[model samples]
Target chain A: MTEEIIIAGFGGQGVLSMGKILAYSGIMEDKEVTWFPSYGPEMRGGTANVTVILSDTRISSPVLHEFDTAIILNQQSMDKFEKAVKPGGVLLYDPNGVIHPPTRKDIRIYKVEGTRAAVEMGNPKVFNMIVLGGYLKVKPVINLANVERGLQKSLPERHHKLIPLNLEAIRKGGEILEAN
Target chain B: MGELRLMKGNEVLAEAAVRCGCDGYFGYPITPQSEVMETLMELRPWETTGMVVLQAESEVASINMVYGAAATGKRAMTSSSSPGVSLMQEGISYIAGAELPCLIVNVQRGGPGLGTIQPSQADYFQTTKGGGHGDYRLITLAPASVQEMHDFVELAFDLAFKYRNPAMILTDGALGQMMEKVELADQKPRWTREEILARSGSWATTGKTPDRQRNVVTSLELDSEKMEQNNIRLQAKYQQIEENEVRYEEILCDDAEYLMVAFGTSSRVCQKALEVLREQGVKVGLLRPITLWPFPSKVIGEMARKVKGILVVEMSAGQMVEDVKLAVFDACCCVPVAYTGRMGGILPSPGEVVEAFEQKLLKR
Candidate 1:
């Protein structure tokens, strides 16, 4: 099975890191993964996006036009990537700051208050993890154990103590996801 | 097995160089490829492997430093993007002339001059056709994946040393920036002084030992006939490489009616295009050239006789297509060879390639 995902948001929102964690989780499960980010001026305090492909076989092109899932964190990304989602695919978004929600009829849409949950948890850094939690709930492609290991692998050794907190944020994100 | 880690292609290249027992890395910072030097700095291989990593003031200086290190029979390398690579052309030519064994990586970005910092294969002709001048060929390896990016480091070094000529890894910004799972090479110890003397002592600029004639490394041949002889020798070595080191991969060509030729990032895109065309009842195949210098002309010539048409795909305004046409010219003159390319770092999608097939090759 191959799942192509695009995660897009503001530059500072850990859009690329979330995709990195997901791709690493694919590796943890003995799968092939590719993570390609939109580089250059688009990454300078503006909208940034990363395409992550997890496949059982070899992945050909890291740059893709369509995605099985589009995880949008802002209105700009929602407007940009809503139509690129494949039919019967999942489009997860954090309802916080998305002025115009996705209006695609063919794909599945889910909203999780990831930013609000992060604020509640007293750590804004876990916001992306919460959003990732929402994605895992909707797709369930990668298991929690692999994702926990992925976090451990992606993060620096000094940050290992924060794994439990990030796990809590992810679980809370799954718990708070609302179908819309 | 070595440890598996998810890394960007540029970063993994540095890691592979260190692990492969590279002696030194000298390169200037360039966009889409600075990570090569950056990762080397962060890893601090000086402490572990004694791999000297230095940031030179300019691309010219970096390449010349590589030339100096390589002349000493040390495993030295440098990397840059298109514009920066252009600056190093003279130094590269000198290295090729001196028969220096070194590795040069071009993480190509789009350009005639100062183009966008996006992926481009425009440097294909420049690289394979000898960018600097005066009769020489670099063993060019084009890597389509991050795994190959790691693997080609050692392969390029080995080929460079075996032939005593410069070798290059021709990649693009897309592969440089993309991240993938890579099984790294086992850590190799750097070559000892005794090893260098035993292996390359005949020509290496290590020093003038009392027992042997003084070894001199020079590209200057003031005598016209002697220069002609030098060119002939370089050509003979290139001919040897052409015969022995031609590497390519053919995908789904068993029953293919049409063939698409591509390399590096374009090959990956064409792989997807091949899948799409097959789904749409088009009998198309992909021919990916792993070694660009030894252009795989023989394989393409054979395939050209069987396929009805050829489609050349690249991130340039048709460079390698000239080689493709030259390869197939004598095989079948009637068979049409069509070219489709994206310039200035624009990457054509799979659907676009399929569209090009219909427009250029398929009959309506």
Candidate 2:
């Protein structure tokens, strides 16, 4: 099986890193994966996005227009990517700053309080982990063991001590995600 | 199995360069290609393999630095994006004229004038048709995967030295920035002074020796007779390359009726489109040119005779299609030749590609 996902948000929201960790998790699961970012000035304080593909076989194209899942973190991302999700695909969004929620009826929509949960946990940087956890909760294609291994692989050795905090953020994110 | 690791294309290119015993790397950072230098800095190959990695002020300076290093019989390279590559054309032309061996990587983006940071194949003409000036050809390699990004660095260097001419790895922003599984090559030690002297001692500026006369390396020839002779020599070498170095890959072409020609990122997309078209019972095939300069024109000409139509897809306004047309013109005049593409940072989807094949080529 192949899972094509797009994660989008503001620059500092860790949209790209989340996709990276997810791709690494796919690697831990012994799967083929690819992570391609929307590079350039758009990554400097403006909107940022990344396309992540995890497949059982070789991946053909890294540049794709459609996605099986859209992880929207901001109003702008939702506005742009809501319709990009395939029919019956999952659209997960963080409800912190979204003014107009997604109204698409073709795909499954879920709201995860990723930003609010990170705020409660007293760490804004964990916002993306929570969002990633929410994605796993809906899909659950990759297990938590692989996710932790992925974090170990992606994070620096100095940051290894903070794995517990990140794991907690992920669990809280998975718990708070509600289907709409 | 060699150490399998997931790495971005640009980073893998840097690592491969170090592992391949590259003597020096001089490059200026550009969008979509900055990671090449960044990875080198982070790896600190200077401390490990004694490889010299310098951040030059401009692309022109970087290419000249490669030329200087290569003249000393050292394995050297420089990398830049589209606009920066344009600035290095003069230096590149000089390197070719002087018959120096070096590698140049162009992670192309949209063009004409600082178009966009998005991936593009617009530089196809600039790269294969001799970007600089005069009658010269850089052995161009178009890599479609991150693995090829790693593998091609070594191949580029080998080819560069084999013919004593510049070799290029022509990729795009997407391939440069994308991450995938790559098997890293084992580290090779830098060449010793003895090895350098044995290989390039004849023409290299290795200082005057008591036994042999001093050698000079220059492209300047005041006498038109000497200049014409130099041009003839260069043309003969290019002809040898064309005869022996043409490289390409044909996918599903044996039973194919419609042919699609693409390279680099566009070829990977075309591969995906081929699968889609096959599902719809369309007998489509894909031909990807690995070596753009030696260009597998003969194979394309042969395929043109059998296929009913041909579609040339690119991330530009169909620059490579002109070559395809010339290759097929004499073989099959009745075969419909068409071009469809996306530019300015936008990538065409498999659906769009199939639609173009059906509408433009199959319809005819």
Candidate 3:
């Protein structure tokens, strides 16, 4: 199976890191993964996006025009990637700063109060993990065990203490996802 | 087995250089490719492997440093993006003239002049056609994936030393920034001074010895006839490389009616387009040139005779397409060769490639 995903949001929203964790999880499961980021000036406090692809076979292209899933965290990303999602695909977003929500009829949409959940958890940095948790709950492409392993691998040794917290945030995300 | 991990192409380049026993790395910082030097500094290969990593003040200084280290038979390298690479053209020409073995990486960004920080293959002409002045050719390797990015470091070094000529890894911002699973080569020990003497002592200016004449490294020759001789020798070496070092990959070409020629990032896009077209019953194939300097003209010539048309895809106005046309001309084939591309850091999508093929080749 192949899953082409795009995760987009503000630079500090952990958009790139969430994709990195997902990519690491795919590697742990012996799947081929590619994480291509839209870098340069756009990443410096502007809208940042990363395209992550996981496949059983060799990935053909790292840059793509369409995605099987689009995980959006901000209105800019939602507006940019909402139409890029494929029919029957999944679009997960956190409606924190989004003024206009996605209005796609063909794709399945889900909302997670990532910023609110992270604030409640007393760590705003874990907002991305919550959004990721909501995505995993909806798609179930990768298991939580693999994701935990992914978090361990992607994070440095000094930050290993935060893995449990991130896991908690992810679970909280799954519990709070709302169909839209 | 080698160590496996997920890494960005630029970071993996630094890691591979360290693991491949590279003697030194000298580079300046540039967008889309700054990670190469940053990772090297972070790894502290100087402390671990006795490898030297230095950030030169400028691109010119960095390349000249590579030239100086390489003249002594050391495996030295430098990396930069489009604009910075442009600044190194003179040094690169001098390195090629001196026939020094060194690695240069151009993680290309779009440019006429600091155009954008996004990835582009516009440097194809600058790289494969001798960006620097005079008649010189660098053994250019285009990596389409992060895995190839890791593998080509050793390969480029080997080719550079084997031919006593400079080699380059031509990549782009996309590959440089993209992360993928890579099986890194095991660490090889840096060459000892004696090993350098044994391997490259014949020409390298290692040191004056009692048993042999002093080895002098210089591209300068005041005598006109001697300079002519030097040029002839350089040309002969390039021809030899063309014969022995051409590398490329062919996919689904056995029964292809049309062929797509691309390299580096464009090749990856073509691969995706090939799949989509095949599903729609279009008999199209992809030819990815791994080595750009040699140009793979021979194979393209042969394919040109069989395919009804050829589509040249790149992230430039049109550079590699000229080589494809030349290949077709050499083969005495009258097949139509069309060019489609994106410039200034915009990568053409797979749908665009398919549409270009259908519009330029199929309808015509």
Candidate 4:
């Protein structure tokens, strides 16, 4: 099975890192994975996005025109990637700061109040992880155990203490997700 | 499997250099490829393996440094993007003229002059058909994946020394920045002074002794006759490389009625296009040339005889397509050749490639 995903948001929203964590989790499960980012000037402060692919066989193109899932964090990303999602695919987003919500009736739309959830959890840094947890709730392509291992692999040794907090944020994310 | 890790293509290039016993890396940082030097600096190979890593003043200085280090029979390399690579052309020519073995990586970006920092394959003509002043050919390897990016460092260095000719890894910003799971090779120790002397002792300028004549590494031969002979010898070496060093990958070509020829990032896109086309009941195949300099003309010629039409896809405006045309020209086949691509860092999607094939070749 192949799952092609696009995670997009403002540069600091951890869009790239979210894709990286997912890719690492795929690798931990012995799946072929690729993480392709939108780099250079756009990454400075503009919209940032990453394409993550996990497949049973070797992956072909990292640059794709469509995605099986689009995890959009901002209104701009929702505006841009909502149409790019496959007809019957999934569109997950955070409702914070979004002016217009996704209106696609063909695809499954879900919202996770990640920004508010992170603030409530007393650490806004776990916003991306919360959103990731929401994605796992919907898809569950990768197991939670592998995701913990992925967190261990991706985070530095000094940051190991934050894994539990991140896991807490992830669980909160799964709990707060709303079907739209 | 030596060590499995998910790494960006540029970072893996540096890691591979360290693991493959590279002696020195002299490079100036540039976008889409600065991670190469950054990772090398972070690793500090000097502390572990005595490898020298320097930030040169400019691309010109870095390539000349490579030339100098290579003169001592050391595995040396430098990397840059398009405009920076353009600056190193003269030094690259000098290295090739001196017949010094070295690796030069161009993690290419869009360019005519300081173009976008995004990926593009526009350097196809410049790299494959002599970017430097004289008639010199760099053994160019085009890597489509991050894994190939890791694997080709040692391969390029080996080929460079095997022929005592400069070799290059011609990749784009897309492949350089993308991350993928890679199984890195085992670490190999750097060559000792004694080993360098023993292996390249015949002609290396490693402080000549009384047992042999002074070995002078120079590309300058003022005499016209001597220069002509030098060119002749270089041409012969290039011919030998063409015969033995051509590398390419064929996907589903046996039953294909049409074929697509591409390399690097474009090849990856074409792979998807091949699948899309096949799903639409189109019999298409893909030929990915791993060695861009050798051009894989023989295989293209052989494939052209069987296919009805061929589509050449690149990130440039029909650069490698010329070589594809030349390859098919000699086959004496009436097959048509079409070109499809994107420029200035925009990658063509698989749907676009499929549309181009149908529009140009099938006239639908």
Candidate 5:
């Protein structure tokens, strides 16, 4: 099986972290995973993106014109990547930050206040975790427990206390999705 | 043969060097290949064996350290990315000039300068054609995968010793950072101390014995006559390498009308393209130069008589294609200058390479 996703937004929006978390989770599951950041002048601050490929087999090229899913966090990201999404693919948008929405005729679009959800959980850094929670609810590639373990393992010892709040954030994000 | 372990290409080469009983590793940290140093540091192989590991101040010192250890007639190696390798060229030339056997690994990144931190096979010509100086050859090996990184280390060391010349592993960051399931090779017999001494004792500067004269390992020949003789000896050794150590990999060329020339990561991508083209009934083939030095001239020279044209793909602006043209000279039966390239860390896709073949051969 293979899963390819693009996490995109302006710099400092934590889009790259979502990609890293997904890739790290895949590694924990004994899957072949590669995380490649878009390089050169493309990353100069207008918009930045990362491509995460998780597969049972080797990943060939890191370039992707389209993704299986796109987690767009800002207006620029949505405007740039929405058309590249495959027919019937999903777009997870951050309604609190992204002002523009896709007008495409063929795709499932979910607009959640991922940033607000993260702040409500008492940690703004858990914005990536909230997205992960929604992603798990949608895909279920692995159990929520595995993702929790992955988060613990991903951080160094100095940041160990942050794991619990991130876990709570994940649970809260899932509840938000449930209420919606 | 054994179970596969998930490892980066740089780590694979480090472990391979240890298994081959490499006497020492002297390297500085550089991106795309920092894991090589990290792996060697974590291994701490010195606790049991006497293998020395030192991080030098620069590539200049590291290559010189290899020069010293190799004079002791033991296996020694150093690794660097492109810029570092460029810095070490004078030392590399000195090692070749003095006839020392050591391994140099170039985990290539894009460059005419500090280009970027990405994989590129742009160092092909510098590696193949005496980048350091004065009519000499360093046996070069290009690996296409993490598995080959492990497998090629022993071959590189053995050939370096056999020819008493430096050998290089030409690789890139993609191969370096990439994690893959790799099979570790079983251990084998290594050269004994006496055997090493016998092979390299002629001029190792090991100190004077009462029974024999002192030896020095230097390329300095003050007299023009002596320098001429030294150049002649170097030429003879290079001729022997050309005859015996030309290594290459050919794939699906049985009825190929066009051949794709590539090495390192580009070769891996080209291999994927070749498979696809064959499925589409395009008779595409690949000639991947494993030893970029010796140039694999004989193969291309012979192919010049058979194929319609050769499509040379690289990560740089047409460097190795120059070598390919030099290899096939006037016997150019086809449009040999065909090139498809991208710069610094930007790798050509298998799809991009497939189109190169299709445009040149299938559509024609």
Candidate 6:
């Protein structure tokens, strides 16, 4: 019966892909889910945002004006979406790339340098995985085990060898942030 | 039921088509709808399951291939967005004239000219009111959910064969690009080629038979009276679909003072509007027409008997509202149907639609 979460950042930061992982996890948990992204012109270096709604009942609207959780990967994203995070909600920011920080005091902000963490693991593209990992621990919208299975099924057979790396990135993200 | 996977809407549609054992698919590259072709190409259905996946050079050629495949009583389909679909009107007319069953899908983008690659529902008139010439109707289905994207493929084929007419799955870019969960249906009880061919071969041009006259398929005729008869037959079939197969969904309209009507993705936003409006203690209802051609006029007319006003919400500029007006004769019963929406891929928020429903249907 919970509401919505929004993930946003500059293009190529894999914001939408991370949102998709959450959507897959939510659906695996038998929740009604819907995902929407900024398409076309708004996708090229411009700000990108995706809305993911997971609920115990049918999802009436896929569009969310505010968020129960907000994830931003860059300063532009934080500048655009920081104020839009729902009152008394949660916020996550990439500690590696963002310069501007939200001054709001009501929401919990988790600063995980997602790209730097993925690069430290020798795969910057797995930044999606790092964000995915942090999302799992932060929002219990679905089971972490199920999200891993979804990633396995979604990736190609040739890319199966990389699943463990992605999982490792997620684990590192969870460990690195929760310790801080 | 199965575990959830992250897949694009177009990818989901192609997977559903293959899982349903669809006989043939033909398509060209068009934004918003191009993924349909890309997924089918990647699926290589023929190498896997004897499914024929062919990419045509043009939308015209793709639709013609659909016409050819459908003549054999096999499940055949082609997809494009608005401009590409415009090029397909010629072939759609030919398919209609020949009375062949085919499924067409339009993942609409903003249009009139080369509208940018975003979601738009502006193709309403071009779809339901005959984008081609002569008097004919395509069984147009507007799906609001990704699950509907999977289910409606079966439903489109069923309705197409049930009437020997072309059916279109009218979706938009939002539905095509978005990701969602789809629990595919069981496949053990599906229709086979043998059964469909047996039922359809009597009128189809399968082969030349010595015992029977030469089988030829054509929409052309030299006889004027026969052409008139053919038109009348098409009209009669349209009437059957209109009277019997119209499908729509109504929410809280019986006690509603205000009503909102929208289809496909727009209807989903209207649903959100219903949620917020009710929280603010507004008596607004949403009517979603699943079948765009059948228009859900009868249902809306019935609801008009109870409600004081109706607000038409669409992704287009007032195309379906015309039907609402025609359905109620614009009666002076406080059942006045008002209209508002945007063009191309810009979807109004639940808040914006709620504002319109309140302003037009409640206050005025």
DockQ in order = 0.78, 0.66, 0.84, 0.87, 0.17, 0.69
Worst lDDT run of 10 residues, candidate 3 chain B, spans B355-364
Highest DockQ model number: 4
What TM-score would you give candidate 2 relative to the actual structure?
A: 0.96
TM-score of each: 0.98, 0.96, 0.98, 0.99, 0.79, 0.93
| lDDT (CA) per prediction | 0.93, 0.91, 0.94, 0.94, 0.79, 0.82
Q: Tens-digit lDDT track for model 3 on B1-364?
A: 7777999999999999999999999999999999999999999998889999999999999999999999999999999999999999999999999999999999999999989999999999999889999999999999999999999999999999999999999999999999999999989999999999889999998889799998989999999999999999999999999999999999999999999999988999999999999999999989999999898999999999999999999999999999999999999999999999999999999889989998999993
Q: Write the per-residue lDDT of candidate 6 for residues B1-364, one digit (tens) a residue.
A: 5534556778878988887878889999988878887888887878866888888999999999998988777889998899999999999999999998889999999988887788989999999999999888899999999888988998998899989999999999999988877786654233465676477767676675577776567789889999999999999999999999899988877678778889988888888889888888878788899998888887788778777778888888889999988877744344688898988678877878877877776673
The true-versus-predicted C-alpha distance at residue B25 of model 6, in Å, is: 1.2
Q: Candidate 1 or 5, higher TM-score?
A: 1
True contacts kept of 1: 0.65
TM-score of chain A of each: 0.97, 0.97, 0.97, 0.97, 0.89, 0.91
Q: Model 2, which residues run further than 4 Å from truth?
A: B330-333
- lDDT of model 4, residue B35: 97
Clashing pairs in 2: none
Candidate 6 positional error at A145, Å: 2.5
As for candidate 4, its clashing pairs are: none
lDDT (10s digit) by residue, model 4, range B1-364: 6788999999999999999999999999999899999999999999999999999999999999999999999999999999999999999999999999999999999877988999999998888888888989999999999999999999999999999999999999999999999999999999998999988988799997888999989999999999999999999999999999999999999999999999999999999999888998999999999999888999999999999899999999899999999999987777899999999999999889989999998899
lDDT (tens digit, per residue) of candidate 1 on B222-249 = 9999999999999999999999999999
Two-chain complex of model 6, DockQ on C-alpha atoms against the true structure: 0.69
For residues A1-180, write the lDDT of model 3, one tens digit per residue.
999999998998999999999999999888999999988675457988999999999999787889999999888888889999999999999888999989989999999999998999899999999999999999888989999999999999999999999999889989999998
Deviation from native of the Cα of residue A2 in model 4, angstroms: 0.2
The list of candidate 3 runs beyond 4 A from truth reads A42-44
Estimate, for each residue in B308-330, the C-alpha lDDT of model 5 and write its tens digit: 77889899988988878877785
